[model samples]
Target: MDKNAPKIAIVGAGVVGLTVADILQKDLNKANITVIADKFKEDTTSSVAAGIFCPGSSFRGATLEIAHRWIEDSWYYWQDILKTPEASTAGIMELSSYVFSKEDYGVTRNSFIENLVPIYRSVQGEELKICGPDWKYGSYFTTVKIGCDRYLPWVEKRFIAKGGKIVNGKIDSFTDTSLRQYDLVFNCTGLGAKYLCNDSNIFPMRGQVIRVKAPWLKTAFFGDYDTYIIPGLDGVATLGGVRQYDTYNLKVCKHDAAAILDQCSQMLPDLKKVEIVAHKVGLRPHRVPVRVEPELIGGLKVVHCYGHGGNGVMSAPGTALNAVKIGYDFLKTNVKNKI
Candidate 1:
């Protein structure tokens, strides 16, 4: 390791921060990189996520073009991993999903992935009946799911083996004394940015999900009202959820669990019989046009990369790549004006 290389600090150990760390280490072979976070693996919100690649139509970046690029780049990044022998250990796998809506046809259509996925098309005649006769609209598409349960540790091990440092600590502010030694910082703190950056736009969009033993379920399912069924590694499948905007409650609500179980069971009755493995809650860092710009804070060069909401798992790589590009450009100049 070069003792004088530019020091880079990455905050947050969730999917976003770790993804940025992984890519940064790969892109800058000898750059001193450290990942600082208070939580890891199962303790982080990313662990509770369904990890499906399908983004809600509302997922956005600064603009439609930027958003499209993020989705496209992310799809190819995961695709590359899926083709490798280490895919299973990395917790990435190809999954075919069926999104159904009984009310709005628009819900079944995803503009972000329609042209990107190999098999994204409308469901024909009896295809809708597979879930139930009442289903009026549906679309089948191929995508990937990243199981952070396995992915976080998998990436962390590779990162450490590559000489990347991991620090288990909390960063209360960008100017925290602990960060003074670093030349640059990448802020991927997710919802924690709400307080750290004084960012009012980012808030907790609480989501609750239940993991169940359903080895028989191979395909993902989505119904109206934010309900979804996503298969994961092993025999565990995730059934969820409710999107309560501006809600900060992280404790699992039995009522919400009951509703989720009822809704999911209605779509696929077999779910009612599956053994419940765990109930999880995640407070998504909901923000429109996800923050991905550079700023000089207290004479420190910083690049912000949080606010991915529920799409962080699938979109992390692309946005992280973009953040790295901006950070490199920012590093080229010595200007320190706060922006």
Candidate 2:
């Protein structure tokens, strides 16, 4: 640690937390950094995400411009990383995906990433036959997927190598620690923030998925009704899911499992025969718009960066970069300057 550097702590171990740590390390080279979290790796909601780069139109920031900036910044951040040798090990990969919908044409369109990604265009008539018949609306686009299973560990290792520290314990409250000890703290604790800040706006959007061996499946597919088959780095592909609103149930529902299999098999009948690897459930920390701002609580400076919903993995870096800028501004605060 640099003796003159400011001491900083980041709370949370998910993609958002790790991304904040990564950016902070780069931006504040001399700062002493430590990541405090009760959960890590597979324990995080990030791992459960299919990690497609498509952000819903509903995903927002404090303002529309801010939202678009976050999305654009995040895309380039991953694109830069994808060009490196560590891309695969970091679980970053270029992916081609097909979005199909029979009811709503808008469901097959994405304004967020349509013009941003490398490729975005209407699917050709023959391309519609790639999945199955009767698909009225369809679009094909090239994007990226970050497998948190690999990304979390990869980032954590890099963080530590760069002189960052990790403390594995749940932070009950920001007031639990001395405010003066660290210059600032970043709150990236996902659903944990609901309790930490008593935020009612944040709720859980429950999701369930099945991981199965399907290396032959190279492209990603999203059918109607939250049904998706996303291929991962390994031969395993994720079949999902159910977005039960305001539901915190982490236990996999048998009914959801059956329904997922039914829907996925309908898209590709061969899925019915794929060996089941595992069934998992996670509660996405959902809010109207993702929270990314600085707050002063009980004399401690903290930046809030949670409520990413299902798009956490895809958007974490962009939001984290913004959060780090806020944290830095708070640390350099003049007594009369207001945040």
What lDDT tens digits, residue by residue, belong to model 2 across residues 293-332?
Answer: 9888777888999999888898898899899888878888
Highest TM-score scorer:
1
Candidate 1 residue spans exceeding 4 A from truth: 336-339
Q: What residue pairs are clashing in model 2?
A: none
Q: In angstroms, give how far residue 96 of model 1 lies from its true place.
A: 0.4
Model 2 misplacement above 4 A: 178-180, 336-339
- Pairs of residues clashing in candidate 1: none
Model 2: lowest-lDDT 10 consecutive positions: 330-339
Q: Give the TM-score of candidate 1.
A: 0.98
**Per-candidate clashes, comma-separated:** 0, 0
Q: What does the lDDT read for residue 78 in candidate 2? A: 97
